[model samples]
Target: MAKVRLSAAAWGLSAVAAGTLVVGCSVSVNTGHAKPKILKDKLGDTVATRLAATTGQPKPDVTCPEDLVGEAGTTTRCTLTTGDGSTLGVTVTVTSVDGDNVNFHIKADETATPAAN
Candidate 1:
């Protein structure tokens, strides 16, 4: 019957649409496996100073989590607390560093001050 034929065609079209969606949504895995450098706050004074300058805030007294080290050239999560009792949590990618000055890209949650309104 025509109704049976139409139903089969609709099922076939649905299957094709599902296949197309799955193929279109497929993503290739990244091949790069470079490991990122793990820097701890207790390692040395350089890391402490660098973290302080990078965040423009004082270093935190708490221990830094090991999982903060992300893949190289990728965003790494970091937390810094200033002496004034303010806390900053950020995701940053380090570009370069020289002495106490560090250059980096911040991903989000960069807070400075409340805007005057």
Candidate 2:
């Protein structure tokens, strides 16, 4: 009887540990940090083409790196620039993304200011 109880306790502890591990590693869909493959499949080609054309830069440099952060339902980045005269090096936060369209809010850094009209 004692041995059976001990085995049951061990099984229970193992189950709890497994559950905790699974929960801890679970990914949140809203976290903007979805799997890279998924993001690439969904927005990869389109984003690359658009950014390349808009920035007039080569294909390699226009790629989005992993570890891009998504905050408040948008991805944010700093020091991103296009090859063209128009620069987006300021601290820019994406507010929303719909299909190929992305809405962003830009907070200009002192070093990179907007041109006067």
Q: Write one digit per residue (lDDT tens) for candidate 1, span 50-105.
A: 43344343432323454323333544555433334443343445454333333344
Best-performing candidate as measured by TM-score: 1
Index of the highest-lDDT prediction: 1
The runs of at least 3 residues in candidate 1 whose Cα sits more than 4 Å from the true structure, single-residue gaps closed, are: 1-36, 42-47, 51-63, 67-70, 94-109, 112-117
lDDT of each: 0.36, 0.33
In candidate 2, what residue range of length 10 has the lowest lDDT sum?
A: 1-10
Residue 28 accuracy (lDDT) in model 2 = 27
Against the true structure, what is every candidate's RMSD?
23.0, 23.5
- Give per-residue lDDT, candidate 2, residue 7: 28
Q: At residue 24, give the lDDT of candidate 2.
A: 27
